[model samples]
Target: MTGVSFHEFRITDSQRLDFHYEIDSETEKKTGEIHFQSNIPIPFDPDSVALALSTMCGSAYRRVRMDLRVSPRARKVVESFLRCELSAPARGGVTPERRRRGNVLSFSGGFDSLAALRLMPDDTNLVSMDFGGRFSTEKPFFDKFRPTVISTNIVGTDFQRNSWSFMGIGAILTAPIHAAKYMTFGSILEAGVDNLRRLPLTSRGQTFPPFAGAGYRNAPYVAGITEIGTAMILVTYCPEVVNDSLASLALPGEEKLYRKYVLASIAAERAGLTVDLKEPPPPATRRPFGRNFTADFLSLYIRRFGGAQVRDAFLTDVPAEIDALSERLALTFYERINTTIMQKFPVELAGGLYERAAVAGLVPYTEDDWREYMIVRDALAPYHPTVAR
Candidate 1:
C-alpha cells in the first residue's frame, strides 16, 4: 500500500491499451498507454505487460516496491532492476513462456541505430517507437527498413527521461509480438563507458539482467562502436540516408557537431588510426563537451591529429594532453564487437554473426572509402561551424 500498485490494463481498442497504476497510498491512479500500429492488438500476457509498465514508469515512484502480477522469472527481473536502479525491494507472481527466436532492434533511424542495423542479422526485426508526433518525419525513413512502427504518447508524460531501462522499452514490448528472443538496442560505447562510466558493456547495474530474466537476451549491437564510428559507417554505406533523414532528425544545434565528428573519423581512418578501447585517462579539467560524454572522444581526436588542427576544424575547445598516447589505448570497433557479441549471444552463434557482419562490410572503419565520405562532407560542410581565422 505504501509502494506503487499496478492495476490491470484496460484495452481501449485494437491498437491501444491503457495501464493504470497508483503511487504510495494515492487515491487517484496514473494511467499510461501503449499504442501499437493499426490492427495490432496488445499482447495478452499480463506478466509481460506488467514488466513493460514497470520499465516505463516505475522510476517515477520514490519507494520501489512495485506490486503487480508477474511470473517468478519476470518478478526477479523487475526486482533486480528496481533494486539496482532505485535501491527498492520490488515484489510481484505467473505467466506462460512464449516461444521466441531471432532478434528485435529498437531502431530510431539515427546514425548509431543504422550502424546497429547493419551489424545485426539480416532477419532482425526493426521496431521504432514514435513519440506522439516528435518522430513523425521518420516514419517514411523507418519504412525503408520495413520496420514495425509503434506510436505511443508515453514520452509526452512527465515520466519520460533518458535512462538505460527506458531505452529498450520499445523492443521489449514488441519482442514477444515478433517472437524475438533477443532484444537489441543501438547503445554505443560512448553511452556506456563515456556517459555512464561503465565498462565490459555487460555490467550488472545496466539493462542486461532484467532483459535476460524476461527470456530476452540484451544485445547492444553498436556498443562496441563510438558515435564517431557510427557516423563513419553511415557515411560509407548510406550517405543518402544520413543526408536526407538522420541529418534532419538531429536537434537544432547538434547536427553541425555530429558532422564535424564524422569528418574527424574519416580523417582519422585515412591516417590509419583506429579507435583504441583502452579507456582514455580522465581529463585533467572538465571540458565543454564533458557533459555530452564526447570530451574523451575529442581528446582522442586531438591526440590522433594534432590538437591545434582538430580544434580549428571542429571549432571547439580542446583539452590539454599530458602526453602523446597511442591509438592502441582505445578499443577498436572490431575488438569491442567480438567481446560484446560472445557475451550477448551464444558463442556458436556469435562467430557466425561476426562473420556475417564482416561479409556485409561492418568492419572497423571505411579506410579506403572516401568517395561517399567526401560527398557527404562537402554537402554538409556549409552547415558546419566555420573556425575563426
Candidate 2:
C-alpha cells in the first residue's frame, strides 16, 4: 500500500484500547490493541493515540494520513515526522492539558536504563512496555523500582521492523497520563553518534520535536556517556542488579564482543593489570556500520587497559591516519558530555548529574576541547564512505 489512514480508537476494556486503520484506499481495515495497567479507564488524548499508531505501522507506507481528532499543537508536531508524510486534522478546543511536573523514564531494566535511573531525579516515574512475554524475565528487576508496566503486541509483523519511532512511543503516550514534564530514555553515546560517518554529535534532532510538541521534553539521561561508561555506573552503584538484568539480546556479534571487552577492561582497571581479550575482535565491515559502539568501547578499553596490541586489533581495518583520528575522537566522545545537549533537562538536575558523573571519575571536556573535537571531526568526515562519494 502507498499510504495508511488512522480511522478510530475503541476502548475494548478498561485497560485496553483497540484501534482501526486502513491501508492506502483499501476497503478493508487492520486492527491493533494497546493494554495499560491502570484500574481506571485512563483518558488518552486522541492525538497521542494517533501518533503512537503512526510510529508502530507508518514506516511501511509512504504517507500516514490521520482522520482522528487532534489539536493544533499536535498538527504542528506531526510536521517533524520526516520519514513519511503524516497528516492529522486539527480539532479546536481539543488540546490536552498537562500541568504536573517531574519526569517519566521509559525504563527497560537494562544496564543503560539503570544508569539513567541513577542520573535522573529520585522521584522520576518509571514506565516499561512489555512485548507480550518477551521481557517477562526482567519483571522482578523492574518491580524493584515500582514501575508501571504496559503490555502490547502492536508491532508484531516483519513489515513494522523499520518503525524506529516506536522506541519512544510508550513514553510519549504515557507522558500525558503521568503529567510528566519530560519523557526520558536510556540512550547512550553509541546510539546517538554516527561514528562510522560524520559525527552528528546530537541524538534528539528527529525524536525531540514530537515530544516537545506534545508538551514533554525527550531527555536522554545517558546519551552523553558510552555503554562502557554506563556499565561502570551500574557496577559502581547497582552491582546486585548488574548480572541478573544485563543482557545483549539480538545485538551484533561485534557489539557483544565490545560489551564483553568493557567488563574485562573494568575488571583489569580494578585489579591494576592489563588484561587480554578472551575473544578476537570482529573483522571490519563497510559503512552503515553495525558496530556503532566499537569506537567508544575501544576508547574506554584503552583508557583502562592501555594495551597497544589490543587497541591495534580493533583498528586493523582502518588506515594509519584515520585510525589515529578515530582513537582521538573516540576518547573525547567517551569522556565528554556536550553541555548544550543537556539543555532539555532541568537545570539543577543536569548540573547535579554532571557534577556527580565527574566525581565518579568521568571527565567533562571544556569549551576549547569541544571546539577542537568539532574541527577534528570535520577532518575525519572526509574518510567516511558516504562523504568520499
Candidate 3:
C-alpha cells in the first residue's frame, strides 16, 4: 500500500507579508537578507513581510538566515492591520483573540506544518481554518495541534465565467468549464478583499486601497463588528519530510504526471492569464500519464476551478536578486507534490485530490473562461500580488 509516505501539507498564501517579530535594537531591524536566487523577479522593500514567503515558495531556499529585527513602526502597522477578527457573535459577547498560534508548516500534522510548529516562537497565536470538505485530512492535523488549533471555515459560495464562446478568455480549445485562481466571484473573493484592506502596505503609511472596485464588491462581507473579532493569518509553510505522519491514500504517479505537465501546469499559468488554456487534446486521448496529471486534471475540472487563487493577505515582492540568485530562490517541487498528497491534502479534502494541483507545477499553463474569470479577476485585482497586478 505504501512505498514512501505521502504527507499532505497546507500553504496559506499572501500576495504580501510583513513579519512583525519582536526586535532587540535598531540596527538589527533594518538588516535582513534572503539568500535565494530565482528565475521569478521579486520586487518589494527589505522591511516588507513578503520576504518571508518569497524566500520559501519559488526560490529553492533551504535556510532563511536573518538577523532578527523589530520595526516598531512596521510592527504596529501590521499588528493593527492583521489583528482584526471575523466571527459571528450575537449581541454582547466575550471573544478573545485565539491564543495558540498554529503556525503549522504543512497542515498534515505530519510533515511540513509540524516542522513549522516545532520551531514556532512562544506566545504565537495558532489559527486554523476548516474546509467543510476536507474534514478528515484537516482533523487529524488539528488533533496533532491538540488544543492549539483555532478553527474556521471556507466554501465556494459563487462564480462567473468569461469568454469561451468567442475570443473572450479561452481559445478554440475552451470548454464551458475551467478553473483558474481568478475564475470565482464570491465567498473566497469577498473574504480575501476584506482581509487585504485591513492590512498596511508601507511603513504604516498607505491604507492599501482596492484597485478596480475590489473593496466595493466585497464590502458586504466585512460589515459590522465581525470585523473586530478574529484575524485570518498567513503562516510560513516550510517543507518537511515526516514519514510517521503520512496518509496511505494517493493518486498514481502516471495519472499525477499527465495532470501535471498538461492540465495543471497550463491552467495555473496559462488558464489564469489567458482563459480556456487547455490544449486541444481530449480527456480520453491520453492514458493517465501519472498520478500527478490525473489528480490535477480531475480536481481542476471538478471545481470547474474555484479555490485556485487562495490569496488573501498575500505578500508582494521585496527586492530580491532572484534572477542572479536563481539557486537560492529556486524551490524544488520535485517531491512536494507527492509529499502533500501523502499527507492527505490539509486545507481542503479536495485539496489533497484537487487544488494542490493548482499550486504545484501540475497545472503549469492553462486558461480561464474569459466570461467567468474576468467577473472575479478584476474584482480581485486589489488583492493580487504587486507583480501579478
Candidate 4:
C-alpha cells in the first residue's frame, strides 16, 4: 500500500454482489469494499433523510467531504427509498415568522461585524458589546461608517482561569446585559446559544432566564432574546456533524467548528437562507478579514493544525494575552480541562459568555468554520497547548 490508493469496482448482476479493492502505491496498504443486494430495499422511516444521505454520498452535499460510489442498481433503489419511508416529513416553513422586521448584526467594529453592519439597511439598529474583549472600537468604527448607529456596551464573566474549556475564551454568552435593552423588538438575535446561556448573574442572584434548561423558552433567538439592542443567532450548519461529535474533537476549535456548522445551519434553515457550510462564506459585506465570532472553527482547526494557530490569531489580532499568561496559568487550566485540549498551556479567558454557556453543554457537538482561520490558528496553537482551539 502507498500514500495514495484508488479502488476498482465490479458487480455481478446474477449474484447481486459487488466487490471493490484498492491498491495504494505510497502507503503500501490494501483496502477493499463489498456489498450484497437483498430481495428489496430496506425501508427507512425518514425517506428524505435517505435522499439526503444518498445525495450526500455524491459531491452535491457541501457539508462534509465524503466519497461513496454505488452501483446503478443501488442508486435506483436509493431513489425509491423515500417512497418507503414513514417518518414525519420535513415541515416546510416550520420556522415561525419573526413577528416584526429588524436586523441585528453582532456588531463588534471588527472587520466582519462592521462589514455586516455597514451593509445592513440604515433603519436596522446598531448594537455593540465587548464580552470583556477589545470590541469597544465598534462605536468609533460605526461612526466612520455613519449608519444611524445606536450602540451599547456589555460586560461578561472573567474566565481566563478556565480558557481550556469548550467555551470561546472571550466570547460573550448573552451578549451581556445590553442585549436586553433591545430584546423588545419582537425580533431574533443572530448569535449562538452558548452566548445565551452565559448571561452574568447580578448580586440579586438573577441573570437571563435559563429557557432551554427549563423549557420556558420556545425560540431562543426571537422569543427569549430578552436583551435589547442585540441578537446572537447561531446561523451555521455542517451536514457532516450529527449529534454530539464535537466533544471528542482534540482541540476546542474543532468542537467550535462543528457547532458553527450547526448554528449556521440552524440560522439558514430557520430564516430561509442558503449557506455553504463546507466553507466560509464571505460576510454579507466586503471585508479583508472576518471576525471570529463563534467557536465553531476552532476545534477542527486545532485538531488538524494544533492550538498554536488559534493562539496567534487571537493574540495578534484580538489582543489576547496568551504569551503573557501561558506559563502563569498552564497547570491551573490543565486540572479543569480534563478532556480535549492539552492542559499544559495557560488559557486565561478575559471571561465571557462562551465559557459560561459551554460548561453546561458538555455532552458534545461541533462547528464548521475550520477552513477559514486555520492558517493563523495553526501557527499559534503550539505556544498555548491548552487553549488550542
Tens digit per residue, CA lDDT, model 3, 299-319: 322223222221001111311
Question: How do the residues 195-218 of candidate 1 rate in per-residue lDDT, one tens digit apiece?
Answer: 223235464224465466557766
Quote the positional error of residue 29 for candidate 2 in Å.
9.7
What TM-score does candidate 3 get on C-alpha atoms?
0.23
Residue 83 in candidate 4, Cα distance off native in Å: 47
TM-score of 4: 0.21
TM-score ranking from best to worst? 2, 1, 3, 4
Worst 10 residues of 1 by lDDT: 380-389
Task: Please give the distance, in angstroms, between residue 174's alpha carbon in candidate 2 and its true position after superposition.
Answer: 1.5
Every candidate's CA RMSD: 10.1, 5.4, 24.3, 24.1
Between 2 and 4, whose lDDT is larger? 2
Sorted on lDDT, highest at the top, how do the candidates line up? 2, 1, 4, 3
Question: Candidate 1, which segments miss by more than 4 Å at Cα?
Answer: 1-3, 6-8, 21-39, 58-69, 84-95, 133-137, 194-207, 255-257, 264-289, 302-315, 322-345, 356-389
- Our tally of clashes for model 2 stands at 0
Scanning candidate 2 in windows of ten residues, the lowest lDDT window is 283-292
Model 1 residue 179 CA deviation (Å) reads 1.7
